[model samples]
Target: MNGVSLQGLRVFLAVVESGSVSGAGRALGISQPAVSGHLHSLEKRFGVALLDRDRPIAPTRAGEKLAGHARRVLAATRELEEEMVRQRAPGGTLAVGASTTPAETIVPGAVARLAAECPEVSPRVRVGDTEDTLAALLRREVEVALVGQEPEDARLEARFVEEDRLTAVVRTGDGKLPEVTVEELSRASFVLRERGSATRRAVERTLRAAGVEPKIAAEIGSNAAVAGAVAAGAGVGVLPERALPRSPGVEPLRVKGLGFTRPLVLVTERGRRLSPAASAFIEVCLNRDGR
Candidate 1:
């Protein structure tokens, strides 16, 4: 306590500038008693009477000197804070990646919000399968990655940022097919993402639980491709409803025994923390509406 704390200095400055403990408390959003306590603490720490606390609280001679330095420190700190905020604003370009589904539905809106909040920050988004997104994070290719589940590698730290319910996407014509059984889904021709996709893994696992082996006919690389295949009556697929495109071809149908839901993650290297801008973007992504 020999060296005055910034908080103490700030209190000191507020009191000096406002010329009253009550006034200083109002300015600092603190109680008047708290302001008095800080003044006493500062005086005891510096071993000098810093304020005339009788009627109109004014800084003594030593208090004036300390007040001046406090103003400079506080002013400089304010400038630094403002600059940090600017650096965090989304006006600059951020490298980001997402798996097929979230990239289409969740990320675009999050990016738009970031863009609006920080006009200076632009994001370069890459759409890929989950494996690609995880690989990019490992290679330091992107600042942030949004993907389902997470890779098992210890080099990366995965955070559960979002959750999406899995749905059976059927041809619009088949949408009315009454509550279908998991066995029925297993028998239906299935379009799925390429191997290594977390969503595909969840779909497979859910089918396995039902004692039904999924008859996956096509291994598509993207959600769009899978949706297209299902729309073309190639096969039905499991996907998140949010990722569905605004086309007339396919419809998401709810099915029983399809225990296929997965959490989405935001990942970065274990020790390598994100840049301020990247961190801000991660926050924006986490703030997305539940899908």
Candidate 2:
């Protein structure tokens, strides 16, 4: 019992689950000989044959009792590890990649508050279009990704932080009309974000669904660019509400049939264990009030 290791217990559990020495080896990605060695070591420690050692192996009464204790030990060890890590102050750099909307809107506030709580962490954010941000996350350029659109890949996990709504903006005093139909706006030239921008895609999809295609005056990159073009009388621009404060000389334009909302998400590599700093960053992001 003194030398009975968590690893040996794991091997024992695998054998019990698989019901064969060779099957347990295959399941555990170990050789059959290694499996047998662990089982032998475990049995020697207890001075009892844990398994019947026959085809479709079965556990003895002692093995059943030991397996239960092993399960508790492993579970308790995992809990202890998690609790200790959580209680300890985490300190490190947390790399994050985000699309334009989330980068400007969420990352700044989240990181600022995180700094207040855990000053040791430095959060670095790379801002790009949705396509590029997701690419950076997949390439390991960032430990986390904040994106406007939910990622579809199975290998990446997305956690919804908030819902973002899009609004149309026009140069101030361009028209006294406070509201216009989608059909009316369809006739006017539109300042748009460049393709691969989530806001642009949402605007385009919404317009297309209304049976109208927007007339492009200019296709610019980033929300600021789009707003600037619209402010300079380029055209009507669609932007997330968070970008509104940055947009000067542009007034909100209500376009009927132009409603679009998307969930802002925090994304990470599925099944990958994150560092303490990365975990803290995610928690901060998730708890941020998207004001």
Q: What is candidate 1's lDDT per residue for 1-291, written digit by digit as tens?
A: 576678888888888888888898899899988888888888898899998877777888999899888889989999999998776554567899888777877787898878776667778888888888889988889988888887689898887876788788888878786688776666788899899798899888877877878887899887777888888998888877676666458887777755578888888888886666687688787776633
Q: Candidate 2 residues 128-213, lDDT tens each?
A: 88888888888899989988888888889999899999998888998688779877877988989888888888888888988878
What's model 1's overall lDDT? 0.82
Clashing pairs in 1: 90-121, 91-120, 91-121, 92-120, 92-121
Alpha-carbon lDDT, every model:
0.82, 0.86
Q: What is the Cα-based lDDT of residue 254 in candidate 1?
A: 71
Top candidate by lDDT? 2
Best by TM-score: 2
**Poorest stretch of ten by lDDT in candidate 1:** 239-248
